[model samples]
Target: MNNFFPAVLRLIAKLVILAIAVIAVAVIVFWTPGKPADELAERWATPPSLFMDLHGMQVHIRDEGPRNDPEPVILLHGTSASLHTWEGWAEHLAQHRRVIRMDLPGFGLTGPHPREDYHITAYSEFVIALADSLQIDKFVLAGNSLGGRIAWTTAAVAPERVTRLILVDPSGGYPLPPKSMPLAFHVAQLPVLGQLMDYMLPRFMVRNSLENVYANPDLVTDELVDLYYDMARREGNRQALRQRFQQDDNGHEQAIIRSLEQPTLILWGAQDRLIPVANGYEYARDVRNSELVVFPDLGHIPQEEDPDQSLQPVLNFLGLAEQR
Candidate 1:
């Protein structure tokens, strides 16, 4: 019996060592750091894509549709997302109204902010600067997730400039942290594990994060994953995200929502595990002129998940829809 126990223990130790060795090899094979912004821009930034020097950073922006249309709509993408996220919406909306979208600092091809500022207020200011640079006096603002938070804040600070607001699962006023977050995001929140992400990122991790946020798991295709993965590896992008995660949460949620007087549309995914649909109701109640639309089968990013279905209500709200 004593000999049997010793033999089993030795076998277990060998198996453990072999497992560790396999993992080490896998890490070495997949330790891809990603391409620089210049290289990615070659493929990602095609025609109609323009880079403007704003706040000392080269901002990637796309202005589409009718330039003469007043109150041009400015679309803001969420954390880790690029202007391409609005491609579907911009395509349709641009037909009637001028549509503008940009890759925010620390995300997409914009990489990181020179000042290393990722706060909501900083984003708000960046929006204003972008608007000023474009000579836009008044415009309609729409955003999803982190972009939504910036939209509302900009309205509060410069109500005269933001004629209306569209918030799609905004983040500033989350009653609580998301029920579930992407594993990469969870890792980024950690003190030590986050450092490892700065140096190494696995394509599977990006794929996993995309799948988690989407209502349909199958939407996380290879091309989609490649877009996110390449952008994340863009120099300084990962580090900027880490800084953003570490920043203090902006408080006074109710007050911020209450202060909004612009006609508002609150869009949410009922199945959103990130920011629950309940938040859409709270936003509707607080904003006197606001209307909430919840997608029963959608997740956090209904806009991207099903743009055709999600954008119809927005078109109606903006009075841009063709009358039947």
Candidate 2:
């Protein structure tokens, strides 16, 4: 019996050593340090990309199209996504209407908010402040995922600023958990794992998250992964991501959805597993003036997956379809 106890202790010690070795190897393999926004700007922030002082951060933004348009179209990308996500849509939309898209406080080159307040209310307020800074009286607000929630919230809080609403797989209408959350997002919500992520991030993690949101994993190219990976590595973004997940109330203020008076267009990926297409129906049912469109083959980020197909409805909604 004494020998048996000694053997067990020896085994336990060996296992502890093995665990430490494994962690050391992982740290060596995935030891990605945060990069200053200036370091990444040379490559990611080219022409048309400018940083403007707003809301206590140098906001990364792209403003395109005719300046005379009274009510421009403002596009907001989802969590973990930068303004690049809307590039395909922006390229085309800017041809006709003024399209403004930015890297929200927690993501992209904007880094983390000084106050570290990632509540949906803070995001909505930031949008309003951005509009005011641009001297825009009214705008057609369009957003996807978390950005969708912010868009609707902005409309609810500052109805006078939002002339129309376009929600693409927005994160609201019932607080139900995602069918399949991305590995990175899941990690960001965990205490230990999220803290570790602030220091070491693997390229594959970013790629896996992209593949999770994309219906066709093949569409997740190395270039796409590089962009997302680089953006995530922006100094303070990792910590901000963790804060965002913690602050997320999962659409607690969604009751205001029913009270939205602006014309609404709802878009969803029929194949979306993250938020599910059913939420699209919920938005349509609650918002009195809303239309829902679902794409059979796309996933959570239909706009990025298939911009051409996803943008047709938006064009029609904006009365620019005939022009195309």
Candidate 3:
């Protein structure tokens, strides 16, 4: 019996070593770096794409429509989403309003911020600087998820500059965890496991995240997943995301929301799984003069899921119905 136990132990050790070897080989075969901004710009960067030096970083922005529009509209996307997420909205709003969207630092072609600061304060400052550089004295600010949080904070900081505020499933107001989170976000928040993603990321992972955020999984296309996958590989982006998740402390959300006095429009997807639809009610309750519109069929990104339907309320709220 003792000899049999020794032999079994030896066999288990061999199996463990073999498994390790296989995993190492897989990692080596799939190892990859994020696509360069220049390379991604070739395919993703379309007409009207402009790059500007802001805070010593190259920012990718699209300034569309009539420049003379009284109050220009600035749109900000959610985490892991690029300025491209606003493409549908930009197409419609640009007719009568100058719509501007940019890839935030640590995302898309903009790459990562040198300072590695992804806090709300830093993001709000970035928005102000971008507006100042563009000489936009006053503008309408709208954002989704993280961008939404930044938008309200910006309005609180410079109330006079932001004529109107729009929040689309914006984060903050409530700290309750979602029913389920995107696997990629959960992995990125891990310690050692997150670092492995920097070396190798499968395209399927991107697809899964897109699927998770969209109300309809069919909306997740191969090309859309490619854009997300490639941009994630952008040098320094993965690390920047890790830092942002690790360092972000959303304790001051209540104070920020309570202090907001701007005319706010809160849009949310009733099917939103990331930041539950309940938070939408919380936002409307806190913001004194705010309107909340919930899309029964949409998920986290209603604007992208169904822009035509989602943007109608925004137009009405912004008093741009005449232009429509």
Name the best candidate (by TM-score).
2
Off by over 4 Å in 3: 1-19
lDDT for each of the candidates?
0.89, 0.93, 0.90
Off by more than 4 A, model 1: 1-27
lDDT for 206 in candidate 2 is 92
Clashes of 3: 2
Q: Across residues 20-104, which tens digit of lDDT does each residue of candidate 2 receive?
A: 9998898888998999999999999998999999978999999999999999999999999999999999999999999999999
Model 3 Cα lDDT, one tens digit per residue, 268-287: 99989999999999989989
Model 1: per-residue lDDT, tens digit, 16-61? 9998898677668767675788899998899899999998888889
What TM-score does candidate 3 get on C-alpha atoms? 0.94
In model 2, where is the ten-residue run with the lowest total lDDT? Answer: 246-255
lDDT of 2: 0.93
Backbone clash total, candidate 2: 0
The alpha-carbon lDDT assigned to residue 202 of candidate 2 equals 89
Question: lDDT of candidate 1 vs native?
Answer: 0.89
